[model samples]
Target: MADDGPDEAGEPEGPDGAAGQPVTPDRLRAFSDGVFAIAATLLILEVKAPAADERVWHALRHEWPALAAYAVTFLVIGIAWIHHHNLFHQVRTVDRGMLLLNLGMLATISFLPLPTATLGGHLRGGDASAAAVFYSVSMAAASAWFTLFWHHLCRRPQLMLPAAREGASRARRNSLLGPVGYAAAALIAPLTPEGSLALSAALVVYFVVGRRAPATRTRVLAE
Candidate 1:
C-alpha cells in the first residue's frame, strides 16, 4: 500500500491511475461516523420518565438545563467529529500515534451524555457540589483529551490537512477555554458550587455562540 499513494481527490492509484482506486478515507470515515452516531444515540438512554404528575412538571421545568448541556456537548462533539473527518480527508495514511489519539478522543466523547445527565440531575436536586464537580470534571477531561490531540498533531504536522494550519490554531485556542473554565469550576466547586456551574454554563454558551476573529487566526497560522 506504500506505493498506493492517493491522488488529489483522495483516491488510491490503481494500475490505470489514481482515479480508479477507492478512497481509504471512506473506511476510516465510516468507522468514525458510526462512533459518532452511537454516541449521539446514547444520550437519550439517560432520560427517564417521571413517576408522578408533579414529577412530570418538575422534570419538564428542569429538563431544559440538562437538555441545554446535552445540546452543547453534542454539538461540540459533532464539531470535533467534523473537524476530524475533514482532517483525515486530506491525509493519505495514518501512523500509530495518530491512531492512538483518535481512539482516545473517541473514548472520551462517548462519555459526554453521562456527564450531561449528571449535571442536569444534580442541578435539579440542588446538589450543587456534586453537579458542579461532575460537570467540570467531565468538561476538563474532554478538554485535556483535545489538548493532547492538538499537541500530538502539532508534533506530527505532516499528517494534518494542508488547510488545517489556521484551523489547528483555532482548535488550540478553543481547546484552552474548556480546560481553563473547568479548572475554575473545580476550584470553586466546594465553596460556591452554584457560581461555578453558572460560570461553566456561560463558558459553554461562549463556545457555541462566539466567533474567533480571522485576523488572529491568520497570525497564529503564520507563526
Candidate 2:
C-alpha cells in the first residue's frame, strides 16, 4: 500500500473539528460593518435642534459644543471603522474565541454615543469635569477592548493570512497606544476638560497620520 500524505490522510483537527478548515470572514466583516454604520448614525441623533423660539444664529452659536462633539465622535468612529477593516483584511479565518473578542470590541463602540452626548451637554457647565472624565473613561474602555482584540489575534497567528502576519505583528505593537493615550486623557480631564479633549484629539490625529506597515495582498482561501 502507498503511504498517505497529510492532506490525503486528513490532517488533525482542533477540538471543534475545524483546525485546518478555512472559514471565510465575509459574514463577520459584513455584520461588523452594519454595527459600525448604525453606531455612527446614532451619534448624529444625539445632536438635538434648538427650541422653536430661539434665534437661529444665537442657538447655533450656543449649541456649538454639541456640533463639535458630534463631529469629533463621528471622526473617532470613522477611524475605528477603518482600523477594523484593515485588521480584518489580514485575517484568513476566525475561531470562536476571535468572534467573542470582536463582539466585546463592538460593544464598546456601540456604547460611545452616550458619553459623547453627556460631554456635549456639559462641556461648558459646572459638571464639565465629570462629563469629560466619563467620556475619557469610555474612550479608554473602547481602546482597551481594541487592544485586546489585536493581542488575541497576535496570539493566534493561524487565524491570519501568511502575507499579513508581519503587518499584524506591527499592528499588535501599535495597538497599545490607544489604551495608554486615552487613560492619560482620563487622568487629565479632572483638572482641564478642554485640555483632555485636546489630548484625545491629538491621539486621533497621530493614529491617522502615523507610519504603518506596508499593506499586504490578502489571499482568500476556499471554504
Q: Which candidate is the best by lDDT?
A: 2
The reply for model 2, stretches above 4 Å from the true place, is 1-23, 210-223
* Candidate 1 Cα outliers beyond 4 Å, as residue runs: 1-26, 50-59, 62-65, 89-92, 163-174, 212-223
Per-residue lDDT for 1-223 in model 2, tens only? 2223333222336677554543346767898999989989999887778789998889888887777777777877887887777777777766666677778888989999998999889999999999989988888888787677777767777667777766666677778888889889999999999888888888877776665422222234232
How many pairs of residues in model 2 come into backbone collision?
A: 0
Candidate 1, 56-167: lDDT as tens digits: 7786665766666666667666655655665565454455555566677777778778877887667656676777787778777766766776666665566565666446
Best by TM-score: 2
- Candidate models: Cα lDDT each: 0.65, 0.76
- Write down the worst ten-residue block by lDDT for model 1: 214-223
User: Which 10-residue window in model 2 sums to the lowest lDDT?
Assistant: 1-10
Clashing pairs in 2: none
User: What RMSD does model 2 have?
Assistant: 6.4
**TM-scores of the models, in the given order?**
0.69, 0.82
What is the overall TM-score of model 2 with all chains considered together?
0.82
